[model samples]
Target: MFRFFIIAAEIIILIIVLRSSFVQYLFEDIQNSVSDWLVSVATLPEREELRSLKDKINIRLSPLKPYQQNYVEQITADSASVKRFYHTYCENDDINPNFTGTKRAQLCLIIKQSPVMQVAKRD
Candidate 1:
């Protein structure tokens, strides 16, 4: 019984002393290292966004040339783009029924992440 008490008291005192010593920092370091070793914190990789071509047409009266309109149409034919743009200006079928080709190209330029912008940048 006396030996058990002595051991328990020694353990309590040792813990109290260690809490006051630099060993506490060492223990924290070991804990952090073990935590790092046991599990990696997941994170997404960094990325740069591609800059899209300007929407500003030099022409004052003319619409997009057929090739450019075709390019925009080809790029936007993608399901992802339709899903994206449907929520955007394409949803404005109410507005576009009367507006012309220039207005549609302008909408393509508006969505920065669209593949149309990226493909135009490539071309």
Candidate 2:
């Protein structure tokens, strides 16, 4: 009986591990597809607004000293306005509407990692 229970537990653990891996792969595939779609859709005029906002923010804030620029970048990158714009326009509405603090932090990280922003800062 104990051996049977141990075997059952091992099988359950294996199933859990496989299920998690599958979920991870599924999510990654969906993300990649959405990213491709977003890039294509971003060529449209409506999406141009987001790009323009980024440009404007970069222009408005780039002239500051390095530390000030970092401060402004951090603030603008994580601001509610940016989050709203991304959620309202960039993301699919079918997903969760609530942008949690972690999601906002991820947005900030993306902004900070953007090569376009880096180039803009240089010029």
Return the TM-score for candidate 1, rounded to 2 decimals. Answer: 0.28
Weakest lDDT window of 10 consecutive positions for candidate 2: 92-101
Q: After TM-score superposition, what is the CA distance of residue 105 in candidate 2 from its true location, in Å?
A: 26
lDDT of 1 by residue, 53-80 (tens): 2222214224656765554454344444
Best by TM-score: 1
Candidate 2 yields a Cα-based lDDT of 0.55
Which model scores highest in lDDT? 2
| Model 1 spans > 4 angstroms off | 38-123
Q: How far is 109's C-alpha from truth in model 1 (Å)?
A: 17
lDDT of 1: 0.51
